[model samples]
Target chain A: MAIKVHGIALSTCTGRVLLCLLEKGLEYEIVPLDLANSAHKKQPYLSLNPFGQIPAFEDGDVQIFESRAITKYLSRKYKDTGIDLLGSSSLTETTIVDTWMEVESHQYNVPMQKIIRQMIVNPAYGIASDEKIIEEELEKLGKVLDVYEERLSKCKYLAGDFYSLADLHHVPYLVYFMRTLKSSVITSRPHVNAWWKDISSRPASVKLAESMRI
Target chain B: MAIKVHGIALSTCTGRVLLCLLEKGLEYEIVPLDLANSAHKKQPYLSLNPFGQIPAFEDGDVQIFESRAITKYLSRKYKDTGIDLLGSSSLTETTIVDTWMEVESHQYNVPMQKIIRQMIVNPAYGIASDEKIIEEELEKLGKVLDVYEERLSKCKYLAGDFYSLADLHHVPYLVYFMRTLKSSVITSRPHVNAWWKDISSRPASVKLAESMRI
Candidate 1:
């Protein structure tokens, strides 16, 4: 049976899994959840993900949720066919990859999520955007990007010279980030600007970007 | 050089690395940090982890931070001697393990962190505990545990029959959590209680718990 993902392209995390599928050159279908209607937060979908999050996956009998986890599964399951995003064969390289990936989720994604809620979600849902939150998060994000700039100056990718999941993981939110608060956060740093350009331009990311409406 | 962790036993995250090292039966040393003085957030250590988090790790040439990332590295690097916490040999099993670990971090750990701050961190610093925040987080945490209760009912551990890193990662925060909140959250659900008992009593967990002085 073909691989399947229950997610919408517009969702950055859903987009996260989709980008991995595209990068792996794998065929899959998206069973998009109706997030606006709170359908994803209700039953059936909740069975797929108790947390009522999107981008659940299925391959025959195996089912899993969590976008990052789904991508990890795909990277491992299709290790040979795909680009070897995890670098599973190299312990040291995988160590660095895991570190940067953690950095993305823990440090980068945290502030980005708050900023996205204010800049994108609030506006779309008719909730007032909190300028205070945007300011606070953007400051934190700028500091995070500073570290990224320094890291990227030393290495082509977050993990190292070779592009890995760490770099790809940064693409989705960034696509949304660059669209709303364009240029300044990214373009300010030469290395970060080049790094963002490099990864965002990847065929998989470009394809994913086209589908991200909001 | 022997495995050296720049952290303290009282720190749940530092304890996280220690649990893994003990599980692997590897000899290691804890290079304590003066978190009280904000030393971790300063120079020297900042060079170790730009994020300025506790529990930076070093094993000869390899130096990394982010406690979970460090644990992941240790699991893979010492896969043979230690218990195979990753389930790397089986793709499907690894998928489940990855799924639950993500659930642990994104879902369980998020609320737990907030609750811990309101209850434990605030008290220690002579700050009043935010009952409002504690109540809100505990409600969220209760729901998360409901999911855990259901999952544990069907399987011995979060990832299935195996006691993988998924369970191990919960130990640190939980050690602090149970100390403050205690019993009610964990013991309310029989499966969760039993599962907690089983994992926490494991020799490594017991040893790790002993060091979790807070």
Candidate 2:
């Protein structure tokens, strides 16, 4: 049976998972949950994911949620496909994957949420945008970008020499962020931008991006 | 060479790593970075963990920061000890682990920070507590606890069957929360309270809590 992914195509997280699927050259069905129709909050869907979030996944009898986790699971389950996504099962490489995953979730995700809230969510809710606050957030974000730049200079990917899901997870948010801000922050950080460019230009990423209409 | 963990005992995050180490029956040196003494911000330490966060771990030449990541690394690195701390390599189990981790990080950690700010941090800075606002935050937190109660009714641990790092990540926060909150919100939720009791009774948890003076 084909894998089924329950998520909106346009969602950055869903897009992240979609990119992973495409990268692994796996076929999956997109059971898009209409967020506009309040489908996510309704019954059945809530039973699948109590938190009422996406993107959720179902493969035959198995079901899972959380984009990063879903991607990691898929990577491990189908280990021999397009890329060695999790790296070798050695202690060092595994630690590297573990470390960067935490960095992405804890350090990067928090600041990115702040940026999203200020730039998109707040204004969409008819709330006023404070340029002073936005600029402050941007500055802090710039500092984080600096860290990425330094790290990328040393290695091709966030975790190490391998292009694991660690790099894949960042793709969607970076795309959304770049789309919304259209700023020179990434451009200024040459190594960071270069590494991003390398990943963003992948055939899998391109196919997923196009499918999601990003 | 022995493993060296740099963090203060009283810190909740630091306690998480200790709990994992204790659970695995690993012997390690604890190099306490005195938060009161401004040691975390000093040279060498800051260089190791760019975020300047506590609970940094050094095993031989491999150094990793972030408490959750460190715990995960320990669990995976020492899997031969027969402790099934990590979620299954399967897609579904990975999703469960990821979801609970998100719950621990985004939901639990956020409200706990709010409670700490209003009850401890603000008061430490001589800021007055707003009783009305605290009550509002309590209602928000109560709902989160309700979700936990619903989940614990089915599973022995947060992430399905096994006691993964998801439960361990939440243990410290529960320590602080139970101590500071005078209300019956937590105790009112029977399942949540039962889950807490089970976790608190664990030998590793007991040892970590005692070591941290929690």
Candidate 3:
């Protein structure tokens, strides 16, 4: 039986899980949800993920949600099949990976998502984009990128020389931002821009980014 | 040599790392940073944690930052010492734990911390609490707890029957909220209240809670 992913491919979180599966060269089926009809907040989908979120995963008897968690699970489960994403080779390596993963969760994703919501989602729904909020988020994001610029200067990737889940996690959001919003925040920084180019150019990331267009 | 933690004892993020160490029965020394003096943003600390965040951990040659990351590192490093916080017994159990940990990161922590910042932190600094923001956060928090209530009714802990790192991560924020703000938000939900009692009553949690008073 193939692994089942309950989500829309165009969703940011769903894109996250899809990228992991792509990187692992794993075959899986996506069980699409009707977000327009509020299908996710209803009974069956709620049973899969109590939080009423997209991108829930099902494999055998195990079920999980939270894109990061699902990706981590897949990375650990399929680690032998593809490039190692978790960096479990050593305690130190794994710690560095985990540290940057936390950084992504706590720092980067919030502002990036906010910018997306304001610039993309709001306008798509006929709602006006709040320029002030976008500016504020961009400013905060710039500070975070300054830190990233420093870190990337020291290492090839956020975790270290190897490309881990930390780098993979940034792809969907960065792609969305680059497509919809001003790219200067990322492109302006030398190391950050170089790092972005390197990560986004990966075959797996390219495939995932292309899929997200639909 | 004991692990050296560079953070203030009373700080929430610092308290999180401390709770994990106490749970693992590890000896550690605190190298306090004067937050009011902006010591964390200065040289030595920035080198340890590029983000200039609280609670950077140092053990031998390994140095890590991000409170959750440090706790995860400690849990993985000391899995055999005390109770296994990661629950790496099976892929299923670990996935469940990781899911709730992400829930803690993405969902629960945000509004909870916002309410805390408004109700407690701002007031202490002579800033008035924004009632509207507090109400908004509490409403968002209420919905999250409804989901928690549903999850807790199914399992004894957030991950499952075992008290994993998922539960430990909630302690510092909940403790701060309960001590400073009203406890009714947690207490009102039957299952959530019971789970809180079970986690907060742990010996390690008790010690950490008491230590946070200073």
Candidate 4:
């Protein structure tokens, strides 16, 4: 059976896994759930992901949730078939990739998601945007981008010269940041701007962006 | 030369990497930065971790920051020594471990750290504790623990029957959670309490906990 993904295409985390699958040239089925009706919190879906989160994945008898974990699993399982996402040729290279991936999880994602929630998601739900919170998040994000600016000046990608999962992981949030919020936080830094343009222009990323319709 | 870690011994993140080193029985030296003196945010250290986070690690020519990333590098580099932290012998097992690790990062860490800051860290720095924030964080943490309780009731550890990085990652934060805050969230759930007891009682965890002097 082909691999299956249970998630909405518009979801950021779901888009992350889909982009990885696209990059790996893998065919999979997306089993969409009616998240509007809380389908994810119901019985059958909870069986797939006990946390009731979007983007549960399945391949043969193996099942997984957490989009980054799914992407890592796919990268390892199909290491020979596609681009080397892990970049694990050496211990140092692998450590570089892993380090940036954690930075994304712990640092970048927090402020970015907060910005998205405040500036985009809240407005969509008829809730007023908290300008103060957005300003704080923007400041935090700007500091994070300053570090990225410095890193990209030294290397072509977050991990290194190669485009690994670390770069791919930023695409979804950047798309939302650019299209929905139209933030200058990314474009203000020369190296970060160049890196963003480079990664977001990838054919696989373009495909996911088109699918997201944000 | 032994591996050198550039971080304070008392930091949760630094302790995280130290615990991993202990678990693997690796010899390492702590380069101990004075965070109270703003040493991490200044030059030299910023070059090692541009984000200026604690727990930058060095071995031979390779330098890495981010505690989880450091632990992962060690696990893969020393896979044959001590325990199999990744347990990636099979696809299913690896995915399980990775999924829970993401849970720790995305779900568990957020509120746990928030509560720690509000209830413990603030008072140590002579800042007033935010009771409202602590209550809100505790509610969020309680819900997360409910899921953990459900999972631990089914398996011996977060990932599976064997201990993995997923379980190991929780030790430092839980130590703070128990020692500094003395929160009843974990102890209130029987299975979660049992899981904590089982993992925290490991020889490596015990050694690190003692070193932390919580």
Candidate 5:
């Protein structure tokens, strides 16, 4: 049986797992959930992912959730097949990759989400954007980006010269983040701009991203 | 030169790395910071951890931040020496461990922190507890715990019969959450209560938690 991912393609977490599948050159199906009716948050889906989240994964007898976990699992399981994203069998390199991955989730993703919600989602729902929130989160994100700019100046990628899961992990949310008007948050930092361009423009990333609706 | 952890022992993130060091039987010194004056958020320390977080780690030429990443690096680097907090020598087992570790961070940690802040931190600071936030977070935590209860009933630990980092990741935060009045949020579920008792009573966890100064 082919691998299966049970979530919509357009969702960020789902897209993360899907992109990993594409990079690994694996065949899989997106078992679409009826989000309009909260189907993903309901019984059968909850049984698959008790947290009631998107992108529950299954491969024959194996099951996993959490987009990062699924991506990590796919990378490890198909280590021989895919482009290596876990740092080429070096613990030191993998540690660096793991460290930046944490930074992406904890530091970078937080302010990115807050800014996007304020600058994009709120406007779509006819809710006024909270200027204070946008300002504070943007400041927070800038500090993280400053760190990224410095790091990327030192290395070709967040983990080092090699592209790893750490870089791919940023793609899903960043695709949304870059769409917002404040994308200059990225463009203003030269090394960061180059790194983003490099990763987002990857054949696998670009191919998967094209299917992701704006 | 012993490993040095740069942060106060009592801090959550700091305690996280310290507990991992103890579990790994690694010698480490705590280089205390004056967090009351925001010393961690300032220069020199920011050089160690650009995000200005606690529990930055140093070992000879190696430096790492983020408690989970630090813990992971320690586990991998010392794979032969310590009680393996990662699952032992099995890719499938490691993936399951990784999955639950993500769950602890994303689903479990969020509600646990919110409940702790509203119930414990708020009250201690002369800020009245927000009952509404507490109620909602507790409900969220209860659902996650229900999943834990079901999972734990089937296996001795989250990643399976053997202990893993996924179980350990809950220690520092749950220590705080357990101190809150809403600790019944954990104790109310039988298997979860047993699981907590088992992990929390481990000598390394108990010894480090004692100096936590709650």
Candidate 6:
């Protein structure tokens, strides 16, 4: 049997895993879980993912959840699938991959989540938007983006010259981010925008991203 | 030259790298950074760690920061040093290690930071402490702890029975946590407390933790 992926279409986390799979040239069936109905929280799904989150991977007898973990697992298990998602054999390359992952989680993801919660989720869900708090949070993010521009200026990708999982991991977020920001941040940083354009234009990336629009 | 570790004793992140070194039976010099003096954020140190964080590892020509990445780098580089901090041969075990690392970063670290920010840093630094927000945050964390308890009930450690980087990653937070919580959440979870006792009793853990304390 092929692998089964449990995920919600529109989720950034699920999009993360899907993009990796597309990069790896792996074939798998998507097992859609209804995020609207909290299907993931139920027992059957919980057994597959104790955390009760989507984007759970079931590869034959093995099941792995957590987007980064799943991506790493896929990279390790199917080495011949496609590009070296983990990066080159050199230690420096691997550390760069690890560093970029931490950068995403610590610097980008945390602040971006706050911005999303305030600017998107809160207002969309009928909660009053705290403009002051949102502005403060966005400023923090904008500063971080300045660092991103600096880093990208030095290297072609976040991890280094190579387009590794580091770049891949941020694809979905950037897709939504640029759209939400109306390309203001991306347009400001030419290299960053160019990098985004390059990755988003990939055949696999374009396909996976379109499939994620359900 | 063996290696020089620049870190603060009381810092959780520094303790993370220290514990890993002890576990691997590696010899290194500890150069204690003065947090009060902003040593980490100043001049040469800041250049080594752009983020200006503690637990920066320097070995030979290789300089690495970020505790989790440092530990992973050490485990891989010194493959024959001692116990494997990454994972053993088992796929489940390796995935579990990565899984718990995510759990630490995503769930454990987030709420802990919120609580600490409100209860300790904000108050001590003359910043505002929002008790209401802290209370709300704790309830969110309490839910994650419950899930941890359920997992610990079956396994001996966070990443299953073996003491991997997953367990090590959590040590510093738990230490401060024990000191901070009026009502002990770990104690309430019998299995988790048992696991903590097991890890806490290790000689290396005790020594490294004590020596690193400011």
For all candidates, state DockQ relative to the true structure: 0.83, 0.59, 0.87, 0.85, 0.77, 0.62
* Stretches of model 5 off by over 4 angstroms after superposition: A118-132, B122-129
Sort all candidates by TM-score, best to worst. 3, 4, 1, 5, 6, 2
- The docking quality of candidate 4, as DockQ, is 0.85
Q: Worst lDDT window (10 residues) for model 2 chain A?
A: A205-214
Evaluating just chain A, the predictions reach TM-scores of 0.96, 0.91, 0.97, 0.97, 0.95, 0.91
Instruction: Give the Å error, residue A214, model 2.
Output: 7.5
For every candidate, give the share of true A-B contacts it also has. 0.81, 0.53, 0.83, 0.89, 0.70, 0.42
Candidate 4 lDDT over residue span B30-84, tens digit each: 9988887889999999988888889899988878899999999999988998999
TM-score of each: 0.97, 0.91, 0.98, 0.97, 0.94, 0.93
Best of the candidates, DockQ: 3
Model 1 chain A: lowest-lDDT 10 consecutive positions: A176-185
Q: Which ten residues in a row have the lowest lDDT in candidate 6 chain A?
A: A174-183
TM-score of structure candidate 6: 0.93
Candidate 5 residue-wise lDDT, B57-112, digit = tens: 99888999998999999898898877888885887899899999999887888788
User: Across residues B72-174, which tens digit of lDDT does each residue of candidate 1 receive?
Assistant: 9899889897799987778888888888888987898889889888888788889998888889989999999998998898999999898899999999888
lDDT of 6 by residue, A1-214 (tens): 7978899656778889889888888888889987788999988899888878777888898988888999888888887778888875899889978878887888778867776666666766789977787678777777777777877889888888888888888887766666575357677777777788888998878976787542
Off by over 4 Å in 3: none
Candidate 5's docking class is medium
Q: Candidate 3 on A1-214: residue-level lDDT in tens?
A: 7899999887889999999999999999999998999999998999898889898899877788999999999998888988999998999999999999999999999899999999877877899999999999999999999999998899999999999999999999888888864898889999999999999999989998888773
Cα lDDT tens digits, model 5, A10-123, are 778899999999899999988989988999789989888977889899999998989999999998889898799988578789899999989987888878878877876688
Q: What share of the true interface contacts does candidate 5 keep?
A: 0.70
In terms of lDDT, the best-performing candidate is 3
Clashing pairs in 1: none
